[model samples]
Target chain A: MSHNTEVLDQKTLWGGGRSPFNVSYGKLMIWFFLISDALTFSGLLCSYGFMRHKFSDTWPSANDVFVHFPFMGDAHVPLLYVGLMTFILILSSVTMVLAVEAGHRRNKKEVQIWLALTIVGGFFFLFSQVWEWAHFIHGTEAGAIKDIIVDGEWVTQVVHGANLHHNEYGNVLFGDFFFFITGFHGFHVFSGVVINIIILIKVMKGHMDKTGHYEMVEKTGLYWHFVDLVWVFVFTFFYLV
Target chain B: MERDDIIEYSLDISHTDEEGKVIRKRLWKVFWILLAVTIFEVGMGFMFAGVAAYKDMLMYTFIFLTVVKAGYIVMIFMHLGDEMSYLKKIILIPYCFFIAYLLFIAISEANFIFDIGWVLG
Candidate 1:
């Protein structure tokens, strides 16, 4: 009886070697973490969607709500600044991927340059978010969205500035949601920037070069991209929709 | 001398490779695709604003475009497109279902609240 005795490589279906998923353990773990993080953001956004839908008629329009332009003194520019912030964040994501590609080739200098630009981009985004948060809290000249009797008729009231309890935009709930969601997202971006700075220092110091690979950069790139991805959804659900 | 027999050592500044070209091209392509989509979304937002008749249609469109942009970012930038099929499925399947479940529950509850007229009424 002839026996089939061909030895299978460790990569074979039954044989386990190094990376069954065809990716490193670090990358796989990052993917898992990101998936969970995504669920959290989705929950928050869905809640926003639900509230807005229920108050479709009474909800403040994004156009009338987010019309502040920096240094323009009450010009109704609509989504211009937020749109620019979005573009900058997207550009930063592009730079991050470029850094990852450079890392794959073990090009340390390219990695450093790209990473620095990415950090700058991250800082810019963070600053923009802070400005936005401040503007949101300070609101337009009108005030918190409330009910006021005008000429013996009850009508919607617009006020200036907002806190956890009061909102100058539309509904107090709108202010609450805005602060919680955007603040949460901004914190993520801040963490990403901190991580990138750490990685940037490592690259500049040639630490990654001694390791013979740039997997750390790639791993961080995965995270930064995930942050960018979340912002896309947030911008839509909050700013556009 | 056979070209395939030559061993390549990647330096900090070396830019010579056939494979690198392909990757760079793909990177540029992804950047352009993302930029184009953002511009398109902005244009649509401007066009459809203030038109009461198109409110529902606008919401659906925004959601669709947002999904498209998110897909491209995940697939390309996150390198999921280059990963194995099983790995992709392992990550994507659960995520899609979970988000859908959340949306379903949240929307239903919001509608219930609306019907009860507790907050607004």
Candidate 2:
């Protein structure tokens, strides 16, 4: 016990802050958190894939479901608005990286401009999510429940606008998964926007500039990129596939 | 603080030299790649919508493109590529195994449920 106490006192907890990995402690912690978060997302996506494969025949085609574009008035443009949303988010990510680059050079003006653009991008994506959710909840065409004779009894089947118990978009579980996954992702976007805004304020006020290293901007860039990364998967698995 | 310390904190003039231009070029490269992939995805979606015969192939393609886009974003935009290779492996390798495990379990369970004839639609 005494030997262990001496070792601990000399190095582990009592030593000056050191990163044996050659990375900053803050960055390492963030990467660890991101890895864990990735696992959570993977679990959700894999479960979604399993459910999709099991109900392959009856699954609602994403094209059929997300055909509405803003002000198109039932023009049936499949994936147009969602595609726009994806592009906007990606563009924002570009701005964020640029901002990080500017921070590296300590260009306050460039950082402020790029960070502002990123915030705008985040807002647009979040707005698109709200629009999509509204349309999904209201449904494009009011679906009807059909009755089919199965085993000498009428089986009532519902098909479009989704609720907690039922969904017209093929399976209730599909709606459940869609809402849960996208909603969670949207929440992340919302949080990222808020964080960006806060950091932008800090940059504008020269608070972060005083730190010599704009690691805060870099950290936020990591987060924003992770959000974009997750969206890429969501776009493929949910909308495109 | 000393004048030298203040000077060091206030400005890193070397960062704005040739390195800044390279950084800008890299940022644009990442942006263009992501945009191209997205355009391709949208184009495929438009072409293959309601086409039952091409569905599975299209899905596979989308997955491939998505993975590619994600890898680029992680490696470039997130600056993970600039990190030490060992650190990169430490962060990425375990996630691969975990994903495989998750997929195996969920897919197998889904198949078992399908075999048992319990489906929700």
| Number of the predicted model whose lDDT against the real structure is largest | 2
Clashes per candidate (backbone, < 3 Å): 7, 2
RMSD to true structure for each model, in Å? 7.3, 6.9
Q: Write the per-residue lDDT of candidate 1 for residues A1-241, one digit (tens) a residue.
A: 0011123244473454434555656677899999889888888889898988687657777777777778998777777788888899999999999998888777788899999999999999999988988887777665545775568887875657766866665666787888898899899999999999999999888888786778789889999999999999988988888
> Which 10-residue window of candidate 1 chain B scores lowest in summed lDDT?
B5-14
List the global CA lDDT of all models.
0.80, 0.81
Model 1 misplaced stretches (Cα beyond 4 Å): A1-11, A144-158, B1-16
Estimate how well candidate 2 is docked, as a DockQ score: 0.40
**Candidate 2 ranges beyond 4 A from true positions:** A1-18, A146-160, B1-14, B119-121
**Tens digit of per-residue lDDT, candidate 2, span B17-87:** 47889878988988999999999999999988878799789978998898899899989898888775657
